[model samples]
Target: MDKVIFSFLGTTLDAGYSAGRWERWRPTIALCQQEDMIVNRLVLFHGGGHDSLLKLVIEDIHRISPETVVEPVRLQIRDPWNFVDVYSALHDFVRRYPFNTEDFEYLVHITTGTHVAQICLFLLIEARYFPAKIVQTSPPRNSKRVDKSEVAIIDLDLSQYNQLASRFDEERKEDVSFLKFGIATQNSRFNATIAEIEQVALRSSTPILLTGPTGTGKSFLARRIYELKRAKHQFHGEFIDVNCATLRGDGAMSALFGHVKGSFTGALQARGGYLKAAEDGLLFLDEIGELGLDEQAMLLKAIEEKRFFPVGSDKEVSSQFQLIAGTHRDLSQDVKDGRFREDLFARINTWLYSLPGLKDRREDIEPNLDFELERIADQLGKKVRFNSDAKKSYLQYAMAGTTEWAGNFRDLSGSLLRMATLANSGRIDEDNVSVEIQRLKARHQTINSDLGVDESGNSHQDWLELRDRIDPFDQVQLAYVIKVCKQSANLSDAGRNLFQQSRKDKKMSNDADRLRKYLSKFELSFSQVKEW
Candidate 1:
């Protein structure tokens, strides 16, 4: 690093005022000297301070750099403050004592207050007396006099600063690849769907509405649209996702259209609201039906007119965002009930695409399973493979209609993650599969019982009584048994099917035992139940 000449131009009040707190300046002065920068002179622009404290700072600087000259200039200013005069005085001092290039490689103008700093910087920039670098130095907020001069420096590289500003402006451009669906699919199936989604995205500029059951990758589809649009240069914006359920009443309006300073009790600064921030990008409103009527009205107007007023402002700000909304609810029913706005519903309904539930897409199960397993493996930082027996067990369980995947893709992903975590010897086996299956079945049964549904799909009078009698372990065992019995329609044939499904020689005995236990629980022997 080249030797730099640093100048301190700010008041004691700017450094923060308290009794005996002036000692903090010593460490800061010492830091400047220790750097490749040489301190040729120390100028103290004093506002109001005891002469003893000023002497202490000067003496400390002298001890660190003996050849350094100290010049103390007393400033006469107003009591409360006049910012214009303060800026003029600082500007005058810099012009009068012009820095010689040979004596200083760089000039560092340090300030404590943002207002004072901004004024001083503006003056310097206007006069072309700007330093090679402007550094903001301030004491840590919480500390005693013992640890005073802990400073944080922010280097304002004009080029990099401009780049960051540009990035903020271009923040709406999003990479959709980061958003992935949890379902596993075969290579052929995955590629085909992605290609179709890309085609739809390319052809349409209408608001895309993704409708599906919860956890069926509605959000993922929205992100894919954003990605496809970005890739095709259809829109140079980013994807801003907002779960409408989280934004309630005043929060919803304030979040969508920001408030001005002092608009509300806690409104500190005028912020660019989400709509403004998402300029020209895709705004993903998840659970759109959950938005309050007032907010829905405002959102509808913005979507139709491309403008909205901030919470406190009268001026309508322009918003040129692509609207992508997702919902699990039947909005048409909501409209009929007068809960959701019919007008807003019509706007989003323009280009709606409903996603099929995972259960409806059994063909995708195998591929999605593999994809989720790979994802889980990557997350756990481990390498795992599904053993043939484990894979078969998983397929049978998945293909069975007993387990209703209420959470859809998300539930499948979680199940795979748990299996990945518990896999032994880097391979998931039938025992682990059985254990996971039983656990999931137990959880689902509890949930179903709470919803007052019995095992045979009948409404129970006492759901609690039904729940007590139903064993999740037995349910899982019976589901496997039912799958085998349905496949062969004979006890001996079902046992053979169970053995084939097990994929392990040791598992054959366990399979036979499980089969018998499953039959006993149903209160029927193989001969009585079997059609063959």
Candidate 2:
């Protein structure tokens, strides 16, 4: 490959009056005479009015190294010591220069420019404007003639070294861990998504939307992103988190947009809204889909303009804060249904991310359990550990396909809190876990039954006749069970899923037989009902 060097003319080092110049080495010309490195081309940059000097250096370079080609670029720099001027000049030169890395190995000579120029060169090189290592030349040893000046090449690529590479890799892992609340989650997709969230949190100041089902860590992740940005000194104002679901009516407007004194009957004093309170910081609007149409419209205006009028006030207040919104609602659908504003959705949808629920991320349950236990230890002021049998039993049930984690992480945390509080001598034995499992089953069953009031409008003559056969009280539950059956792969699968919790207590191991017996009472069979 052809060797090319970019260097600035050393006004003092390259100055020579006679043949004695061969005794002293100039960096711009010294790099060309090296035994191992060939200067196939030299692009020299210098301030104006150095035509004579440029002439002498080109002729000298050719005399000693006849094969080297010299190209002179006259730089327009009023002060080489000024960072802005020197950087602009060099930047323009690099921008216009034709760089063909495949055909040539290029080197930037940092030994010739002023300190400011050297720093600018390093910055541009580090940013990868043009790919090249830096060449630094110095005078030779005392006994050796200056003509034999030493040359050192420094490559800025850090990944070539194992230590530096590993350090950066480990730091990135830590950032991802921080976003996950330090849980050692094993889900590949979840881990990769968290890594991307960390990057976006640190790099972008625009709004971020985190969507997931309730208790799926949407709010938690939003706060973690805020903290990460705060730690990086991205913003200094206080973090203001408001759950829009709890807000309602004009009060919602006043709470978010503040109210001037005497704005309303209850407006005893003027208040600075959350937006103004979050100046230069992060404002997390959790459950943002709960905001009314008017509130959403005003919020969109505030987000885009950074200015909003207070209640009953004409003057507008300005705030510069980053926004991170969290919601369990499908906002796109909400937009279509006229429940949410499309323009507002469009503004915040750019960096949207969906967090998987605990049911969807069953592989992470164990680590999250571990994390909860650590928190329990802190909260209750006593360390707790589950015995071998208890942990095995709980994990089996928790990770089972039949288990429905409708409440997501909130359910797990509450369950852990109860068990830890009820532990015997800081140990949760098998019996303790057994009782907790039964309690959890009843809890989930009650919730499921409450939701079984069949509004699904399943109206068929056979179904109506079958429904009339059962008690009015049993119709809701029977209908829900049938729905589950229809959605399942087969009778056994449906029964196994439906009776998973109750199966823990029954002595008989046959879920299918139990389901069949119940169905017989209703004069229905899985094969016949599944078709309906």
lDDT values, one for every candidate? 0.68, 0.87
True-vs-predicted CA distance for residue 345, candidate 1, Å: 1.0
**Tens digit of lDDT per residue, candidate 1, span 198-275?**
556667766777788998888877877787678668878678988988997676789998888888878999977888
lDDT of 2 at 339: 99
Steric collisions counted per model: 9, 0
Cα deviation in Å at residue 384, candidate 2? Answer: 1.3
TM-score of 1: 0.52
User: TM-score of each candidate?
Assistant: 0.52, 0.78
Off by over 4 Å in 2: 9-36, 47-69, 75-91, 114-116, 139-145, 230-237, 251-272, 301-320, 453-532
Worst 10 residues of 2 by lDDT: 451-460
Evaluated against the true structure, the overall lDDT of model 2 is 0.87
Question: Candidate 1, which segments miss by more than 4 Å at Cα?
Answer: 1-197, 460-532
TM-score of 2: 0.78
Judge candidate 1 at residue 188 and give its lDDT: 53
Q: Considering summed lDDT, which 10 consecutive residues are worst modelled in model 1? A: 171-180
